[model samples]
Target chain A: MNDTRQFHLLAGLATGRDARSDDAIYQSLWEAIVEHRLSPGARLPEDALAGAFGVSRTMIRRVLQRLALEQLVTLRTHRGAQITSPTPSEARDVFRARRLLEGALLTEVVGNIKPADLQALAQIADQEHHASREQAIRLSARFHTRLMAMAGNASLSEALSQLISRTSLIIAVYGRGQAGCPCEHHTLIKLLETHDLAALQKWMHEHLTGIEASLDFTASGDALPDFEHLFGHHREQNAS
Target chain B: MNDTRQFHLLAGLATGRDARSDDAIYQSLWEAIVEHRLSPGARLPEDALAGAFGVSRTMIRRVLQRLALEQLVTLRTHRGAQITSPTPSEARDVFRARRLLEGALLTEVVGNIKPADLQALAQIADQEHHASREQAIRLSARFHTRLMAMAGNASLSEALSQLISRTSLIIAVYGRGQAGCPCEHHTLIKLLETHDLAALQKWMHEHLTGIEASLDFTASGDALPDFEHLFGHHREQNAS
Candidate 1:
């Protein structure tokens, strides 16, 4: 499989434009974990990743540490890091937190959005509408994040960004849908343009509810991969 | 000055309710910076801090790195670390961020608070009213943080907590008031208890406005102590 091509595909979706190596790597790894390409309990060895990316261990370590801090990767005592694989309860908690934070942010923005801000959002929605399935999915996710950024709260924006990233990861792992439907975005933009606060709030609440309802949380029962072999190169481990 | 006693005094105000070496070191240095005990542009040497804390240099380094990440302390390229005196633009951004994020969170909590939650909030408000001036200020801060917590958004709560802490630090340096009164808390709690969403939002907006109004940003032209020397003992640098 062409990992790099797959990464580019995901990265293009995330940014609505071509992304650099660091962002591509980060987004690719993030999506892989969320989509179960890198399943929970799978190891991520720095040296192996460095070799794969043709980058320094230092760069890979920085990205890994960032993920670890987000609680998407668990850094064990001496065992190295693995995908978080949030428990059912943690997954529920994540959504609950999102509902409170993002929902409130959306409501506030609905009341205060400027025409210029709406224009920017419309541009993103238009881009999503025309993108490929994966690109569309990525843009759909970024839409809400971009809205948070526009709200002008760095702290809130940072937290929401993390949550949104994690949510994408969760959807990648468990989502079962056509990735590129811009229907929700269309509705949201219309509400914003009209300055209908009540309608906007209702639409946002339903949108999140729809997203949450779409997850397939039933255990897939897929066989777990070998951690050492998956993380360390198969040939390298055998040669050693 | 009894450093340990001073440590205890500040530690009592921090969330832990117990003063460990690291917490003591963090609180003391944080206060020193916020209180202008350690002025901006002063250097902090590890060896000096180690001697002052009666701990190893490793401990000092860890604390310094954490503060650097929070942007409370600046780790210069070759010049070493010092308290971060935020630029005027940065300071304005912080307040702007706070108003948008906290204002939204408060509005949501007010609209959605339950009777049980109101009771808990009342208890905290009562405690704030009866506590010491310093304790009251801390408790009042906690009351807002607790509201975020009850809203059940971990991400929002964490972000707001960090912002509140940084704001408190900023206020310590630039605010005219030496102590925070309980009047605001009382008013906020009353609004929450009444379950009047419109009134609650108004109260929160005004409360934050009042806080921003109290800041004295003009330079006092007071000669401040060296930041490095406040945490660093003169003997240790000479010994080294």
Candidate 2:
């Protein structure tokens, strides 16, 4: 897909704007990376990204630096920037961290969950059921992030969301077919509706463990993805 | 105090270096803020900091940006950067986050605690006991951060560490006299030695809650600190 069309789809933009906010730019790139449209180990050339986003290279660099801080992107001394390829060990650490965090966060979720939160989660689950693989993966991250946000702890929710994003990088590296449990989210929503913290925690632990288990760590890494193919269309559009 | 002297003491440097790595610069400034050497609401002027660190404004700006990402510093449009003066609500959110994270993380710490880990913690507690109040506060943060790192989850450790640093900022704004529980680290170390996970988690929760309770959120905001006094010494030295 062309850059504008892809951004429109990924960012869910109704109409094109001349210049995007830093957050809008970050969100677009973040969603693209997490949804696996931008593969792990893909080079994010600043010039091409600037061209695509119709912004300065400096703006692109700022977004990349923020992503690097979240561990979704790797910035090297001279090598510039690339999507982080989470090592098998790093992948396991991410899952273990999630199990501990998301599992513990259930107490707060149970304490604070309301009908509206349940409805919100159920809606995400429903969307996940019908999305394409990429969209489903993105929706699944949204599901967990949204569920955890109901806990009313912004710090925990923010940290967990970063982990959720990194999970996409893990899936990019080692996923065989599924990046997230598309069907299982509905089950989670059902469990949440019950307000059984133990059951919810148990289910979350098993669910994350299952997703981790399903990954093929034996899967090899990606070769550098084609940035030109990804953003060349935008560069052309910008030039025109 | 002079910036060089402050850096020397805060970073514990034995010798002066011609240049500091970004991490080194970040570490020095981070320690200063968390120790309350750099008060909340203190302006971190780029030119002054660049001179103090003997680096380019660009390098100083990068360090400031990193600090901003961690929420220990706030960067504003046209206003430049300053130490973050967290609102009372933000302070409470930070404590709540720590209670959830550190308390939950104790399970992993208990599972992973070895004699060396305990020894390392005890050493920090020992230092805290002998250190000045500022040093003690910094050591206390080190104590908790080091303790959490034993959980063996880098992501959680990193996330919790940021919260711990922000806790310092919270103390800066709302703290009455104590920044951290200077005397409690030894107690926590003793609890760790007992290997009682539940008790350890309980102590951690109470410990963080107590610190939060001690803060006087009614405290007035800081006046814009005298940057000329804080960094001007280094400017003169640089010119010489």
Best by lDDT: 2
Q: What's the count of clashing pairs in each model shown?
A: 1, 0
Specify the CAPRI tier of model 1.
incorrect
Model 1 over residues B15-79: C-alpha lDDT tens digits? 55332466577877766554445555556777666655666766676678667756677886667
Q: Chain A alone, TM-score for each of the models?
A: 0.74, 0.86
Clashing residue pairs for model 1: A34-A173
Give the Cα RMSD of candidate 1. Answer: 12.0
lDDT per residue, candidate 1, A1-240, as tens digits? 323443333334344543235555677677666444565666777666665665676656657766876777887767887777665455666676677667667655765678788788888899887877655766776788888776665656777777776776666666776453487787787777787767766777777777878887775422354466457787786899
Determine which window of 10 residues in candidate 2 chain B has minimal summed lDDT: B6-15
Candidates in order: C-alpha RMSD to true structure: 12.0, 11.9
Q: Report clash pairs, candidate 2.
A: none
- Evaluate residue A158 in candidate 2 and report its C-alpha lDDT on the 0 to 100 scale: 89
**CA lDDT of every candidate:** 0.66, 0.82
